[model samples]
Target: MEFGYHHSSFATHDDRSPAAALVDRAQRLEDDGFEWLSLMDHLWQLPFHGHRDEAFVECYSGLSAVAAVTDEITLSALVTCVHYRNPVYLAKVVSSLDALSEGRAVLGIGAGWYEDEYDAMDMEFPPADERIRQLRDAIQLCETVWTEDSPASYDGEYYDVDDLYLNPKPDDIPVLVGGGGEQLTLRLTAEYADWWNLPGVTPEEYDHKLSVLREHCENAGRDYDEIETTVTIPTIIRDDTDAAHEVYEDLLEETDEDTTPRDEFRGLIGTPAEVAAGIEEYQALDVDRFQIGVPKNDPETIDRFVDDVMGEF
Candidate 1:
């Protein structure tokens, strides 16, 4: 499975110097043999345990900066909230980024979350059902912008665009959708998505959801395995098991969570051999790509895992 990394707004190393911190992280990702580097999209930061107060950079511009420096990695908004922008304009932004990145772009999108973002910005954040409706419309709008020739138009229930011309439509940039909701979301994935992103589910849940996705694709006359499965593997890897435990210990203290089995919750931890075993086990379950959200954003820790674990992988 191809391994990737995710950025965390929860904490920045040294201080709140987000610019320097992200550049540093990008450099490490390039050096660490990671195939893709994803940045989380957030308008309003949600602090789980008072770790960080607010979001640092706008996700679009942040991705631009990330694309500017990294030459070989796949880059994307880990999942842009659909309600944040009109889908056609969002496609333009993505197309421009893809041109800048020389075609190493993937679109990761999801229904909007964080009510505070909606409330603060005064954008209409509809209820869950309606938001999904908008998400579907947004996906369609993006497709119209990317694939249609001449000026394309759409009049969906939530989105309405008239005679739009995207002169420089991107070349074959794959669209990825986040979430494992079985009804509308999964059905959309089966119909249109090139990739599927899921989170916070057990292995049994994963199996069941994949089964459902396969069933949906069969009914929709689509091949199930054609959609690449990219999973977010939350993890903390260290050269030594004790070092890993120490990181988890610090996390538990910082978050005031129970320490028992904390490493398991964080994801594949332990020595390089043990970590490799865990990753291989997941690979057996048909996960082709993994976005590993590393806990410590330190250079040394990142380098260690890259050398000792990722190299082995």
Candidate 2:
């Protein structure tokens, strides 16, 4: 399986800056054995475990900073929200970032979630139905901007742009989408997304989603296996703590839904053997990529993942 490190960028009250710790994690992800690194995109800071707004980093700026320091691992937004920005500008930004990283970038997109984030920031968070349409249009726009030399024009209910030009197109950059919505989302993913990421979902759910995706692909006249399957699992690997299993269990209780995201991954609990066994279970569901998150950003957890779980894999 292709392995990647995923973390929420948060500030700690005790000491040091969020940027330093984030860089530390990215550097270690490369130093150890991860193929890629991803960070979530958000406008307003949400409530973390304890501190609400102290430690979160701006998504685009931090990602650029990470690209500046790392060369071994690919960098990407875990999933950029569709309703978050203008499609044309974001297309340019994504293409530029891919070029800057020498083609080591993935564009992961999603229909927007978290209404509070939009409401508080005074951005329009359209209803789910409209958001799906918006996502489709955004993908169309991004693809056009990347592949076309002449000005691109698009007309949709949610998006209408004319004669927009982008230069220095990226080479072989992939667009990933996160969702399993059977109607628009999965169909669009089958049609466009290079990777389909399922977050904090059970192997059964993942299998079900993949089934739906396959059906969508069939309907769309696309190959079922063309879009790769990825898993973003909330993980905790404790090197030498009696708290190994409990950490995963308690993390859900402590962190809020908006911040922690995808609360269903509590199965990351248990001993290394048990977690490894669980990983195998997930692998059985045909996961192409696994982006596992470390609890508390502990170096030992990273070591445990590389030494115990990934080593066995």
Candidate 3:
């Protein structure tokens, strides 16, 4: 059970410059034994997680800054929306990051969601099926740009590249498709992705989704074991179980109750020992990695997690 730090919010660092805070946090995470690091790709904080007016940094830019400061920790967006940027440009951006990081880049992508963001940005928010198809097209375009030689041409339904020349090509950027849509998204994962991630799911839900992915792999004539499986677990750790619960309650108070239901705040929310036990449950399921989302990036909680729970694993 390898651990990754999922940097989901910047609200707590409002007093300081985001660059200073992000660099400091990235360095600390690498020193603290986190093998992977991810950031949320959003124009604004998600309604369920924080207030809309909170600080939000662009995804790839944050990863680029972290890349300059850290070594060894794999960096990525938890999931970049397909519609956010042109596929060709996105390929170049990620390739640049891979080159700068010396090949520690993973493209974690998904179909566009958050209709409110779409409206705010004046971007088209297509239907679910169309968005999934667009996501597939985007993945195909990126793969061609990253792998094939220069003067590559790809004809995808949503995007097309004619005589595209991508220089300084990256060496195999792993594609981690995010989402648990039983039909289209799982099929896309089986057909193309090197990794599949589903965040905020229960153990039972994860089991069911894994089974679906296996079926999709079989249908697609792909090996299920070839794809790495990762889950983002929203975690809160404290010295004692009661203290952890108090922290969880405080987080709930900050979040929008209408968007975030109480039950949705599921994951390792307890003392180090209790959190360690919960992690073992997922480890028993053969999960390849756990992306721990420590809300607000609390220093004490992060230290306790790395020192106590992660050490036990």
Candidate 4:
């Protein structure tokens, strides 16, 4: 399976600036056989992952800068929140990035979550059902904007556009929908997305979702094999499993309690060999790609994972 690096943390030392650091990391990832580099699209960090008040970078702008620095790795947001920007405007942003990257751009998107971010930004946070509806409309609108000639008009339940004109359109830009709602989300994925991202689900759960997705694809009269399957999980890799657990513990908040076998962890946290085994389990379920969110800005874990785990796969 191809490996993708998700930039979930923003940590920089005195030796380099954040922008320089990202460039270096991006180059290293490309050299190390990572196929894609995705950045978190949220305006503020999520509390479950990091401090909400911590440093955060805008997604598309950062992607443009990264496109200038790296040539091989495809650049995208881990999953852009659909509610944050107008559907047509998002198409414009992604098309601009695709042009900048010379067609090395993919759009990973989802219905908006993290109500706190929306409230903080004074943006409306609709109910989950409504949000998903908007996501569906946005996907349709994006396709219209990207593929159709300009001066178009689209009227959907949630998103309506008049005389929508998009120039410098991307050449068949791929959309990867991120979510695993067995009903609406999976149906939408089967109907609209080029890729389906399952975040933090176990191998068994992933297998079940694949089944559900296939059923949706059949109902929609679409080929299930056409949609690439990807899974994103936080990975902590070290030379020793115990050392990795120590790092995991350190990363936990004060109120969090440690559990045996790291039950508190939702993703792989162990030595390179152990992590490779975990990936093999997922591979057995027919997962096509893995996007790992390595906490902090620790480059050593990424290097170790590539040298040890990725080589085995």
Candidate 5:
């Protein structure tokens, strides 16, 4: 499976400026054999990663910066929150990035979650079903804007567009839909997305989700092989198992000792060799790519992963 790196931790290290660390990590990941470099599209730091007040950069701006610094790696949000930007505007932003990156932009998006971000930023946090409706509508709107040559209009319950014109469309940018909701989300992925993300799921769970996604594809009259399957997972890699545990402990201490995202990934931790085995288990179920988050944005962990796990792949 191809490997993607998620720059999930934006808190500056005490040793260097935040900008320096971020650039260094992005460039290094590219040089180290990561195919894609992604950032989370959250304004506030999630509680599982660190204090909510810690440094967090805007998603698109940081992705542009990352695109500028890296030469070959594809750049995108792990999944942009649909509620944060208008669909037409977001389409322009994504196509612009594709232009600037020479067609290396992937649109990874999902139904908005993280109510705390919405509450803090005064953005509407609609009910879950309503948000899913918006997500479906936004995907349709984005696809319409990117492909239509003449003026286009859309009328949906959550969104409406009239004579929307988008110029300089992207060159077939891939749409990667994140989230594993068994109903609308999967159906939308089957109908609209080029890639489907199975985040934080075990092998058995991924197998089940794949079955559901295939059913959706069949019902939608879509070819299942056309949609790539990806997994968004937390990867903790070290030279030894004991050292990896130490790194995990350090991450807990930084987050007020909270054990959310860390706890969520307990089943996926190991040395590089062990991690490779874990990844192979997923590959057996036809997972095509992995987007792995390096805890604390540790560069060494990434380097080890490349040298040890990715090399095996």
Candidate 6:
């Protein structure tokens, strides 16, 4: 399976500027054989990651900076909230990044979550059903902007564009939808998404979700194999098993208690061989990619993962 790096925290860069640390990590990830890199799209840090006061960068802007620094690694937000920006504007932003990066951009989007962020930003957090509908509209609108000729018009339930002209169209940016809602989300993924991602799920859960997705694809009259599947797992790797577990415990101590429950959290915390075995479990289920989230952007863990586990696949 292809491996990607997902950056979720900017709070642990000791003496270096956040930008410097990000650039350094991006370059290293690219050099170390990561196929892609993603940043969490959050205005406030997620509770499990840290306190809301911790440093967090805007998603697209951070992606733009990384684009300038790396030549090869594909860049994306782990999942942009559909309600944060108008679809027309988002299409332009992503298209611009694709042009600047010479065609290495993927639009990973989802229905907005994290109610605390909404309240803090003074944006309305609509109900789940409405957000999911908006998510579909946003996807359709963006696709129209990218594929339709100039002066395109789309009338979506939550977004509308009239005679809009999007210049410098992207070189076919893939749409990756994140979330695993059994009903609407999976149906939408079958209908529109080129890639579907669900994080923090055990192998059994992933299998069940895949079955639901396949059923949705059938009902939608779409080819199930057309969509790529990805999973994100919080990872901590060390040469020693005990050391890896120690680091995992330290990470738990540093983060909020609202994190995924221990029994449900499908994180990888062990030696290279053990982590590789965990990855193989997903690989066996036909997952196309694995997005590894290293706690606090730990460089040593990232390096060990690349030097050891990656080669095992």
**CA lDDT for candidate 1:** 0.76
CA deviation > 4 Å runs, candidate 5: 12-14, 260-267
Query: Per-residue CA lDDT of candidate 4, range 1-313, in tens?
Result: 7889888776654577666778788888899899988998888666656676666778887889899988878888879999888788898899999998899999889997778788888999988888888888898888887887888778888788888778887788899999999988999999999988987778888899999999999999999999999999878888888788777666645212333357554588888878988999888988888889877755667778878888897
Tell me model 2's lDDT, rounded to 2 decimals. 0.76
Span of 10 residues, lowest total lDDT, candidate 6: 257-266
Compose the digit string of candidate 5's lDDT tens values, residues 145-166. Answer: 7887758787877778888777
Better of 2 and 4 by lDDT: 4
Q: How high is the lDDT of residue 95 in model 3? A: 93
Q: Comparing 5 and 6 by lDDT, which wins? A: 6
The clash number for model 6 is 0
Off by over 4 Å in 2: 11-14, 45-51, 239-242, 249-254, 257-265
Task: Give the CA lDDT, 0 to 100, for residue 244 in model 3.
Answer: 81
Give the winner by TM-score: 5 or 6.
Answer: 6
The candidate, 1 or 5, that scores higher on TM-score is: 5
Model 1 TM-score is 0.89
Writing each residue's lDDT as its tens digit, candidate 2 over 62-160 gives 777788788878888878988777988888888878777778888888998878888788988777888988888888878877787757777776677
Q: Give the lowest summed-lDDT range of ten residues in model 5.
A: 256-265
lDDT of 6 by residue, 1-313 (tens): 8899889888554798887788888888899889889998888777677766777788888889999989999999989998778788999999999998999999999998888878878999998889999999999999998999898899988799999989887769999999999988999999999999998788889999999999999999999999999999989998887788677767756676544444555388888898999999999999999989887887778878988889888
User: Model 2 residue 80 lDDT?
Assistant: 93
Off by more than 4 A, model 4 = 254-261
The CA lDDT at 111 in model 6 is 96
